[model samples]
Target: MKQQSLALHETMEVHEMLNLKTVSMTTSKMMEGVVFDQDLKALLEKDVQQSIGAINDLQRLLKKAPKIE
Candidate 1:
């Protein structure tokens, strides 16, 4: 299979999404320490897990993106 590099705009959008997900995951992880409600904590944990998967996928896609220099 031929591997194609991502377009500049698509690369930028993916990068932005990766950053946002990273921030969200970080926030959720930190909140897990202070959160008292079991249900809320569980929800945050789930979000963190999903974000991790998404970040991994984004990283793989980024590997194919053209160099920005």
Candidate 2:
């Protein structure tokens, strides 16, 4: 499949989003071990899963983005 190119600003934006998602997922996963409430733990797990999907999508877009020197 042909990869689509992203403009510099778009690439930066995606990179920022990827970083944010990574941090969010990491935080949720860590909190899962500490939270006592089952409901909140479940919510955290859901957020982690959604973040994984979003991070994967962002990584794919980044692969199409031009590499910075």
**What TM-score goes with each of the models?**
0.92, 0.90
What ranges in model 1 sit over 4 Å off?
Answer: none
CA lDDT of each candidate?
0.96, 0.95
Cα lDDT of candidate 1 equals 0.96
TM-score of 1: 0.92
Q: Model 1 Cα displacement at 42 (Å)?
A: 0.6
Per-residue lDDT tens digits of candidate 2, residues 1-69?
876799999999998999999999999999999999999999999999999999999998998898779
Top-scoring candidate (TM-score): 1
Residue 59 lDDT (model 2): 96
Q: Candidate 1 — number of clashing residue pairs?
A: 0
